[model samples]
Structure formats: C-alpha cells, structure tokens
Target: MTDRTVTVAEAGESAVLDVLSGEPADVGDDPVGNGDDAAVLGPAAATVVTTDMLVEGTHFRLDVTNWSDLGRRAVAQNVSDVLAMGADCTRILVALAVPGHTTMADIADLSEGIHGEAARSGALVVGGDLTRADVVVVGITAIGTLPYGHAPVRLDGARPGDRIGLTGLPGCSAAGLALLLDGRGDGPLQQAHRVPTTPIGSGAAARRAGATSLTDVSDGLLRDLAALARASGVAADLDGGALPVHPDLRQAAADLGATDIDARVLDWMLDGGEDHGLLGTFPPGVDVPPEFTIIGRVRAGEPGLVTLDGVPRIPGGWDSARGAN
Candidate 1:
C-alpha cells in the first residue's frame, strides 16, 4: 500500500493567494500578508469595525439564492452597520467556510459579488480566509472611518420626546421571502427576498440632522427599535398605521391567500429580520432628512417598547438562529 500526503498549496492555498493578488481590483499600498504573518496598519481619523455571519440553511438557501446576491448581501449588511454609526466604510475582510463539494466557479462568482457590492459602498475587500466545513458560512468584518470631528451615533442617546423615524419602506424582504417559499416565480417580492435595498446614506444624514440614537433595521423594525429603546433607557411607541408597506407586498399577500396584509406586513416589518433599513430617533424640533419618515416617538420608561396605537407588538423578535428558522 502507498500513502499520499496533501499539502496546503495543493489544497487551494495557491488559489486563495491568486484571489488575494490578482482577482480583486488594484491592491493599494496597504500591506496585506505579503511577507509578515500580520498585516500592518497605520493610524486613521476614525475606525469603525463590524462583523456579521450568514449561515447556510438559516440565512440563505443555496438552491434559491445566487452567488452574486449572497455576496452583495453579506457586504451590504455589514456596511449598513457602519452607516448606522454614521461612518463611511473603508474595507472588508471575509472568511468563508464551504463544503468540499462546492465548485470553484461558485466561489469565484461569490468573490466578484463581494467586490462589486463593496465598491458600491466605497469600500474595498482587503483580505480573507477559507476553510472546509459541513455547510456554507460567510463571515464579513468591515472597517469604516468617520468624518473628522464627528462622533458615531449610538442607541443609548435617545431621549424622551424624540421622534422615531425610519428610512425607506419595510417588510419587502420578508414578503419576498414568503413569496419565494410559496413557489412564486421571479417578481418584485422575490427580488426583495434575494436583495434588500438599504438606504446607504441615511445613517450619516440622520447623524447630521441631530439624531440622538440610530440602528439599522436588520431584524424587524419593532425588534430593533426595542433594542434602541433598551439601550437608551426609553420606551418606543410605533404608529402601526404609519408604516410604509411595499405595494408589491400587498398584492403578493393577496395573491397568496394571506388574509391580512396589515398583519403580514406588520409581522415582517416588526419582527421579520434582514430589511437593513435605518431606524432612528431624533430630538424634538430637529429637522429630519427627507429620506426618513416619522414612524413613532420616544418616551421615558423602563427601557421597553410599545405601539403608538396602544398595543403590544409581536413577541419573539427576529432571531436568526431561533425565530426566523
């Protein structure tokens, strides 16, 4: 019998190196594992770092989502976090774990998707690692820089009498998911599920407009608003009637025999995670930007949430590892 040995170079190390050096666009002066075991970094104005992971069965279904959409979503969500903090994304580092059965072309296409989305947000993909796993998992760590003399907005600053607002419509992604799960063909709802359209600049705009607290509505609007309220030691009151429901979602729900579009929209908007819209609270009398709509108000309380219509919204918030599944 003969024994064979496998080396890192033979097991895709060279392929990884090629991606780092050749595949992505121009590599700037930044030192990225060329020689030393560590990549060096210089001081910058402000540094904002965020990390997010997408699991296979939970965050995405390989059969339903394309490599390009997956890549764009991973980078876009992380960028949403930086924007939530009123920062401009600079670069991202990705870590991928995939089953050995995955094709090289899929991996390459995914990388291209990441590169394209990062570029759209004015960020670059700096580096990453790859490894074998039982399922496909993508982790992205994004770093951003805030403008000179500006502070990152945080959830703890919301105050009583502040107006709660949201940028753009909600429940589109969730509705889209429902449509796809129902075997609906390609359409607006399905597109919403595949690609969430986040308001890229609203975070910074809110900050400049004197927002006291802010967060991206990745996990339903009500749930994230609850988080902001908890962090700020206030109570959030959302006017249920004031929410913006995508027109397509309304039509799709009707087509799918969904009895109450309002309930469905509310469920997705308040507890259906992954929308990536910006939710914020501004002090009274502050001029909110045109992109945002006033959805509710902030009040003094035991760091909890409520509905402006005097009702308790859905429980079991958008927990990816729990509720959504």
Candidate 2:
C-alpha cells in the first residue's frame, strides 16, 4: 500500500467546501452560517461593509508565509477597515481562488486562521465562495455595525483646530518585511509582518472620545493623513518627534548595517503600510482617548498637504498596481 496526499482537485468542490466551513454561526440558538447559499446576520444599527483582496506573490508570498497566516492577514486587514469606520465587527465573508494543486490540509489551516481571528474580533464567519484559479487569491468582506445613536466616522470631518492621533506604532510591520527580505526573519519585527495585531475596538473608543475624523493606518501615516486632509479640506503638520518608534525597528536597522539608521527607521515609520493602527483627529481641547497618541495637528493651509517638522513631506504608501508598499 502507498500513502498519497490529497489535493483540492482530488477532493472535489463539495468536500473542499465542507472542510472550509467550520462550525456554523449560532444565531439565537439556531445555527446559521457558511455552507448555505448566504449568511443571515441578526438585526443591527447602520451596517458598515468593507472588502479587500490579497493575491499570491503580490500581497503576500507563500515562500515566506503559510496559508494559515495568509488567512489571518486577510481577515485582520478587513477588520481594521471596519474599525476605522467607528463600528463594531459583527460578521465576515471570505472568498478564495485556489489552484487545483493546493492541498486540503492547507485549506484546513487557512480555515482555522480565518475563524480564529474572526473570533478574536467578536465576529463570525457567515458566508464565502471558493473557486478554482491560477493562483491563490483571498478576498475578505467585513461587516460591522455602528452603535445606536452614533454616526460612522468619515475622513471629511476634520477641522483646522483638530489634533491628529494614532493608536500604535506605524512601522513595525514594514520593518518586519525588511527583515524577512534580508534573510533574517525572526524576532518581534518579523512577527509583526506575519500577523499584524490591530488595536481592537479602538475605533469606537475614538469615536466616543469625540474624534472628528478617523482612518486606519493601512498605508503610511503621511499618505493616509494627506487623504484625510484633502477630504476635510485642511493641512496636516506632524511632529516628527512625537511619532512612536518601536525599539525592534531601531535594532533591525542596526542589524541590517544601514549607514543612516535614523533615516531608514524614519522611512519605515513614514511609508511602511499594514500596521493596521487607527489614525484620527479630535477637536481642540477634547480629551483624546488613552489609546491614542497625539502625533500631529490639523491646520489652516493648502488642502492635502502634509508636513513633518514644518517641512513638506511627500506621501508614499502601498500601491498594489505598482507592486510596492
């Protein structure tokens, strides 16, 4: 007898789907979730929906990460977007395009990751689609709900007298990616890239704390801030000394033997995307939430202009079309 590995092609769609659908969501003691044609979520306030896609070799590399990590990444990024909206995550929908050669074990690993992260965010996997494709493609749609009487946060609400706030360090994930590319893929920085931890519930916290505008730092701080500035018709001036720099990032720069450690670290802090931290603005004299650090201020100037230490800084963020972050 010979042992053989089973692939998605050999298992067929029904079996693959069965493997992908873990435990169905329990709605009022009645199970309602994936495996059905569509998901049925309970009633809620204003619903907020966001969808994102991750493609193999473009958004991630299989050589550096496993299917489970990819699954977690897909869910985490979308949930971050939901948090940016000042809403609470309720459910998630995943769509996957997998090559035939992929193994069933890999799909199981992916499912585990998806469900695990969803659980962490107080959400459930309600529905999704699985299909055959040339390469692995993961699509995540996160559903959230604004609390009763609270409005969704928008980028256009910032005012000239607002203070800019950030929830967490901005460059950890980017530094992790750099370390991975350098063939030194260990330590906190690398872990940050593998599965970036988002500041859960921070969006709602900011909203309740009188945040006038909000966004997730999925892109670089300068880029996302500029967008908020343009949307609100204001200019943003960042205090470079105020931005938090992770110790791991500084050490990574040293390990890589960069001539300009400060410059390299600053680049990651300014342009490194995927940290999934919350960035927003609060009105003057409002007590910013404890979770947020005041890093900049909104001011009267040219719209969409962002300055660092009183100097105009060009914004650079993730551009999938260009295949760079």
TM per prediction: 0.90, 0.96
lDDT of 2 by residue, 50-109 (tens): 999999878888887888888888999999999999998888898999999988888888
Distance from true position, residue 116, model 2, in Å? 0.6
Q: Relative to the true structure, how large is the alpha-carbon lDDT of every model? A: 0.78, 0.87
Shift of residue 65 alpha carbon in model 1, Å: 0.3
Instruction: Give the per-residue lDDT of model 1 (tens digit) for 41-107.
Output: 4456788999999889878997778987898899889999999998788788888888766665666
Among all windows of 10 consecutive residues in model 1, the one with the lowest summed lDDT is 1-10
lDDT of 2 at 70: 88
